[model samples]
Target: MSHSTVSIIAQCKAAGLRRTKALELLIDTLLASPRPMTLAELSEHDNLNTQCDRATVFRLLQRLTDKGIVRRLGLHERAAYFTLLLTGRHQDFLICTDCGKIEAINAQCPVHALEKEIAQKSGFTGLYHELEFFGTCPKCSV
Candidate 1:
C-alpha cells in the first residue's frame, strides 16, 4: 500500500474505526484525486463504485469527517466537496462560478492572524479557517 493509504488506515484505526474494503477504497480514491470531490464524483469512481454503494460512501465520509480525517468544503454549488485533511497543510480555493471549477491557492493565508486573534480573544483552541473566492473564469467571461 502507498504511504498515504497506510497513514489513512492508521488514522482510521486511531479514530476507533475498523478497517474495511469500502473504507480503504474510499481513502484511496480521495488520495488519488487532485482536488476536493463531491459525493457524485466519489460515487462514480470506477473502483469505488464497483465495491460499495453510495450510501456506504456517504457513511464512511461522515465518519471520517467526524474524526477530522476528512473535511467538507461548502461551495456555492448544491453538492458539498470533501478532501483528506493532511497534517500541517492548509489551503484556500479559487472557484469559477460559471463552470464550478476549483483551483487551489498556494499562497500564504491572509486570515491566519485573524484566526489567531479570534482564538486568543475567545480562548478557543484548535482554530482554523476555510476560504473560497468565486469569480468567472476566462472562458466563462468570454
Candidate 2:
C-alpha cells in the first residue's frame, strides 16, 4: 500500500472518522484515476466498489482537501474536480472540453523565480501563488 493511502486512513481516524471499506475503496479509486474526478463521476465510477453515498464521498473529499491531501480544480462553470496530491509532486490541471477529462501536469516551474523578482520589485514578502492555464487539448482539438 502507498504511504498516502496509509496516511489517509490515519487522518480519518485522527479526525474521529471511521475508516470503512467504502472509504478505502474511495481512496483506491481516487489514487487509481489518472485525472481529477468530479463528485458525480466519482459516484458513478465503473469500479462499483465504493458503497459510500455521493454526499459521504463529498464530505470525505472535503476533509481530504482541508488536510491538503487533495486539490480542487474548478472546471469552467461546472462542478470542481478533486485530484489526489502525492508527496513531492507539484501539480496543475488541464481539462478537456469535449470529453470532460482532467490531466495533471507537474513541471519544475521557473515562474517561482519570476514571482520572487516581482515580489522584490513590488516590496511584497511571504507570498506564493496559484497558476492555472486553460485551452483546448490536442486530443479535443482533433
Candidate 3:
C-alpha cells in the first residue's frame, strides 16, 4: 500500500474533520513551519491574517488540538506553541534555557526500551510518553 500523502485537507477529512478556511490555513501554516509557533507568532503569520483573525485562529487551534490533528507544545512558562501531528513524522525537542531557542530532534523516543521496562514494572499497558530535553544549545553554550 502506498502511503505518501501531503494534502492537509485530505488529512483532516480522514480524521473526520470538516475542511474550513481557518482549519485549512492553520494546517497549511503549521505543516510548512519548521518549528512550533506561539499564538502571537501564528497571529502574525504572513498569510494567515488575510484568511482569519486571531480569535478564529485560536478556536481552530483548540479544535485541531482536540481532534489530535495538531499538538500543543508547552515550550516554556511564557506561552504554549502549536505544531501539527503529521503522519510518519515525530520529533522531540532540545530547548535552550539561556536563549529560549528550540531545536527539534528527529529522534523518536530514544528511550523506548526504558519505557517498556518501566511499563512492565508499573503494570501499565499501552504506555506512551513525552520527552523534552532543556539545556543550552551550542550557540548559547559557547
Report RMSD (Å) for each prediction in the order shown. 2.3, 4.1, 4.0
Model 3 lDDT tens row, 44-138: 89869888899988988887788777787764565777887766566777777776676687765778789889999999996666567877888
| Selected candidate, larger TM-score, 1 vs 2 | 1
Question: What lDDT score goes with residue 32 in model 2?
Answer: 87
Model 1 residue 45 lDDT score: 95
Deviation in angstroms for 82 in model 2? Answer: 0.8
Error of 3 at 135 (Å): 2.7
lDDT per residue for candidate 2 within 31-134, as digits (tens), equals: 88877788888878865324767887888788878866678886657788987766555666667666666666666665778888999999998556555667
Best by lDDT: 1
What ranges in model 3 sit over 4 Å off?
Answer: 1-17, 106-108, 113-128, 138-142
Estimate the TM-score of every prediction: 0.80, 0.67, 0.71
Candidate 1 lDDT, 12-49, residue by residue in tens: 99999999999999999998888999888999899789
Sort by TM-score, best first: what order? 1, 3, 2
Ranked by lDDT, the better of candidates 1 and 3 is 1
Q: What is the descending lDDT order?
A: 1, 3, 2
Off by over 4 Å in 2: 1-3, 15-17, 46-50, 96-101, 111-130, 136-142
User: Candidate 2's error at 94, in angstroms?
Assistant: 2.9
